[model samples]
Target: MPKKDQGLGPSAETPLPGDDTVVCGVVRHLGGDYLLAKCMDGVDRKVRIPGKLRKRVWINEGDIILVGLWDFSPDKGEVVYKYGRNEINKLIEKGFLSKEFINALSEYL
Candidate 1:
């Protein structure tokens, strides 16, 4: 058996903001399973990490995440996806993110 070669690029598909309900955000603060995320829409929302992803995903402050907004609460949302460094670069190249935002986010990284 031969070992598979893994490249430095993103291995899986990088999910984009699919619709109006999904938005891109930056994790600002982490408190247990909930975190304060600054959304691109200019709203600061309290986002929760669902039980399914709680143990599987290790979310941290300063990470770029996809948030699914709640219909009942405008200020609340749930973490749908987290972007890696390579994925973030791909997003920037695709014109989904601005360089200024990446520059600001670099402070946290």
Candidate 2:
């Protein structure tokens, strides 16, 4: 049988917001359905798992995730995506994240 396509091709990356408002964060704590994430920008944001992804995705503390900052609430955001091991390595290679940050996450796991 032919393999079924899983949607993402070469350009599976979700289009980034032009303003650079989205940033990487580490999940610090889980508050039931919400999360307290410490962003790379040095601020802790209350990150919410949107309804669409809530049931499908399972996030845990210390996992690396992408967050889209809220315009009205500077210290709050939505959890956009979670980075897998390979994706994390690629981000580090691309200079999107620092080696120190990756080291930090590893220590927690």
Candidate 3:
């Protein structure tokens, strides 16, 4: 017998930033449920993992994430999504992430 094809594999969809409010970031530090991330826009924001994703997602430094900026606070935001290693590579290949950005992020890692 062969295994059934479920939609929960490595080929799972990787979400892209929907608009200007959402941007790519690299986790710089972990403080419990909150994270200090450096975004592509060159801002360091204190972002939190909302209750819906707090228990479901395990984020760590060096991981790539999508942050949804708060309307009232420019320095704060919430974690919208997390990307896997493969997804990161895909983003790079797709031209969503530039090589210079990834190289700069390497210093933190």
lDDT tens digits, residues 1-109, model 3? 9967543334457878766455556556566788888788888889988987776677777778888888889899998788887888888898777768777777877
* TM-score ranking of the models: 3, 1, 2
What TM-score would every model get versus the actual structure?
A: 0.76, 0.75, 0.78
Q: Which candidate leads the pack in TM-score?
A: 3
Arranged by lDDT with the best first, the candidates are 3, 1, 2
* Clashing residue pairs found in predicted model 1: none
Clashes of 1: 0
lDDT (C-alpha) at residue 8 in model 2: 31
Q: Using TM-score as the measure, name the better of candidate 2 and candidate 3.
A: 3
Query: Number of the top candidate by lDDT?
Result: 3
RMSD of each: 5.4, 4.3, 4.8
User: Which portions of model 3 show Cα errors greater than 4 Å?
Assistant: 1-11, 30-32
Clashing pairs in 2: none
lDDT of 2 at 1: 100
